[model samples]
Target: MRKYLIFIFIVLAVAGCKKKNKAVTSTIPGKPALTTPAQNSVCISGTIISATESQVLFTWNPAVNTDSYDLVLKNLLTYTSTTINTIDTKINATLLRNTPYEWYISAKQNSSSTTTQSDGWKFYNSGAGIVSYPPFPADIMYPAFGQVITPSNGKIELYWAGNSVGNNIASYTVCLGTTSNPPAIKNGLTESQLKDVAVTANTTYYWRIITFDADGNYTDSGLFQFKIQ
Candidate 1:
């Protein structure tokens, strides 16, 4: 009788253990932190592939609950982008020399469908015999291309961000009008924003930014447009 009671107790304990959940807990992926080719800095350490290209090493800190990372590298001059996937923290890529580029990392996990992206960083790929770099094309921050907005105050602000090697920026030129090729409405502005620009309702406007370095090198921000409702 004593042996039977011990066997029943063991069976009951096994059943209790089997009832517990075996699945692991899950959480959203954290944003990756960039390490090398630091933000808004020049990248001078790389193997020279040729007069037009160089191999760059990209490194970043690991994010929590991330299983993989996708590196997005964009040529700011040509407006072209490349995507690379890896399960590691660092990678080597060959890119165009003497050009400005921006990069970011997207983190993903197999257990979840969501993804996290890290902040973007811009760098100039220095090549042999290169002396200076032009400012990166101004990044349009407000009223994105083709965005429709209503100006309650009869005006809207235009803003942009610019960067260059050695911080050699001189001024920015803002061109705005209804035509695709707008004329310069403002020039030699040292600020990043244009405030209190009057607008008309139910009209589309086109604009672009021209960034000039202190050495007279200039880069266009390309064209962007928005509609006022």
Candidate 2:
């Protein structure tokens, strides 16, 4: 009798543990894929909100296990960013006309704290009397902002990717120094990467990129800083 009672209690405890574990499930949201306002494309007017402002429809494919999403829109010229959260997969946003912008989406789930970020895209907002649009700011690859590195070889490489609507990028200019406003160090660079940049240990460096298009329109990448260890 005693052995049978012990066996029954063990079976009940095992079943109870299984049932409790089965009731809790967690899912991480998948990264949302952008659908409209295609990358490096121009977004025509959707609904004109004002003479200088227009409404743009941003759309993306829904993600698995996603409960909500956050859309980030950045003005390349002013380097200002706005984030909007929604449960739906699309949002209409008011933006300045004749502006360059980049956007990305983030997927979130209530069951998990993890948020997935989608790929980023940039577009030009069309406007009246606009003949040419400035190039979007270059995307930095190495020596990111507030990054620290050890310069064993006393040199570092600078890398970035430039984008434009017309694919008419003329040249790239690199600026580097210690001050907040660095002067142009290299110009007329046809490639995206500059190697063998001299650096010293235990010093901070500031850098930025300037992109010029064939139409003479230019865009400045905001400043980034790095420290050498």
Clashes per candidate (backbone, < 3 Å): 0, 0
Kindly provide the TM-score of model 1 when superposed on the true structure, using C-alpha atoms: 0.86
Mind giving the per-residue lDDT tens digits that candidate 2 earns over 1-229?
Answer: 9999999999999999999897775487898999988999989847888889999999999999899999999999898999999999999999999998999999999878999999999999989888788888999988888999876589888999998988889999999998899999999998998989898778889999999999999999899999998
Q: What is the C-alpha lDDT of each candidate?
A: 0.91, 0.92
lDDT at position 35, candidate 1: 96
TM-score of decoy 2: 0.91
Per-residue C-alpha lDDT of model 1 across residues 1-229, encoded as one tens digit per residue = 9999999999998877766543334568999999989888888898988888889999999999999999999998888999999999999999998888999999999888999999999998887786777888899998799999889689999999988886889999999999999999999999989999999999999999999999899998989999999
Q: Report the Cα RMSD per candidate.
A: 4.1, 2.3
